[model samples]
Target chain A: MPQHPPPRPGDERTPGRAYSARFHLLDRQIVTEDGTPLAKADDLELIPDSDGSLVVSAVLIGPTALAPRLRGRPARLLNALARRLTTGPTDHHARIAMGHIIRIGAALTATTPPVDATLHPLEDWIRDNVIAPLPGSGHAPG
Target chain B: MRLADLMGARVIDVTGRDIGHVSDVRLTEAAAPSRRLPGLHVAGIVIATRRRSRLLAYDHRPVDAPWPLTALARRATRHALWAPWTAVTAHRRPPRTGEPGTVTLDQTAASLTPLRDMHAHWNSGT
Candidate 1:
């Protein structure tokens, strides 16, 4: 059987030459293993293996992880919002194992199931009582 | 409607209520793999802010004025909608009137519904 290659990071395009990394990945939404929106790539986790070489193990998401990087007032506001929205950021931030990533294109895609999603109480409340209750909750215009 | 045509089209909530004007369209799909597509995807639309600060920032002028949040909430359906076309993820149609105005929620709205104050009963957590 032919061996499949490791996932490729999504495309990176600018007005000029193509380059990729933090700027392209940071703050971008992370897709679920099942193609759902898990969350954004709030930050990158660089874990050093036994050899002392650091490799990206996962994508850290949620406001708590992001607030510190926002700076100044935005950070303060994001921190407060994160505290209100979640049960405080999880100890490790919502982690999406790099293996789950399916491919990279315009945005990152993953085959991993959603760790963070509509399951949240706040999201559920909004979708059910607020979003779903609306006229055409999840339907497209004809 | 053609996205270009809807550029200045008057946008309203599902209930046909006014919120604000359209600012920009957000494309959210990943770029094509084999062939470069200039990174095409219709992810979601970002509506500009209409807060008092934003208004003051505009200084009562239409200087790239941000959109109203109420209008943005309606577009939560763009991704879920999954229509035949993804060229335009969402449209920004600034409401005709200044205030949210009155809109009755019903079948007349097709797939659109008026965005309500979801935070009314709960503490804003602010």
Candidate 2:
């Protein structure tokens, strides 16, 4: 058997490198260019290539993408609840297209906006209804 | 399809013998058209005979870490196998209620490369 040298930490960021999806991609935090946290990469969208090999298409975020990974009764309930909360006819997880990704390091950086309505509908609702009603909520604290 | 759907799918050989379950997916940056970030192509699937928690990458990577822990991980994944993506003849079936999906391989389990030997192949950059 041939022996190979150990890979240095952070080597996965190197272009054209081979990486294990579980270790390098899944569960990694994703952020926008200005350093605002978006969401963790809960699941990956894989599309078949012309040769029938799978290529990563996008990073899938939110509960709809995560529930299947949890895999059980709780997962089923969570999936059902997420479906009900979703507003559109096509109920699907929020995805950040691979084309938008700028870099993959400790966190994946993308050109996507900080806040997306589809990404966090519940959070948006709470801010608009509950938080907006509070006195002095309009201004950011210094 | 989602990568989550294939994560825990059972691997079956051409003769219908159980091999193992997919432990992790291996990807390589390969050139492809119509992509901004370099395309991550599916390279292979890591299959382990026993249903253990994450391999922690000790099976393939050279991690001489905090002594005993590294030794334990190496022992745990001794029987793991590496099946190239080309060997996979079928994608996973839609998961059933409380059951995992299945991935069928055209080759037999014995013909697959051992996980321990994968590092060399990966380093060769083939």
> RMSD in Å for candidate 2, one decimal?
6.3
Give the worst 10-residue stretch by lDDT in candidate 1 chain A.
A12-21
- The CAPRI classification for model 2 reads as medium
Q: Which number leads on lDDT?
A: 2
Compute each candidate's TM-score over C-alphas.
Answer: 0.37, 0.85
Off by over 4 Å in 1: A1-19, A32-38, A88-92, A114-121, A128-142, B1-126
Residue-level lDDT for A3 in candidate 1: 22
Chain A TM-scores of all predicted models? 0.60, 0.78
Please write out the lDDT profile of model 2 over residues B12-59, one tens digit for every residue.
999999888888998877764533435887888999888655677664
Task: Chain B TM-score per candidate, please.
Answer: 0.30, 0.81
lDDT tens digits by residue: candidate 2, A36-123: 7787899899988877788898999888888787766877887887777765543667889876766666677777887677677666
**Cα lDDT over the full model 2:** 0.77
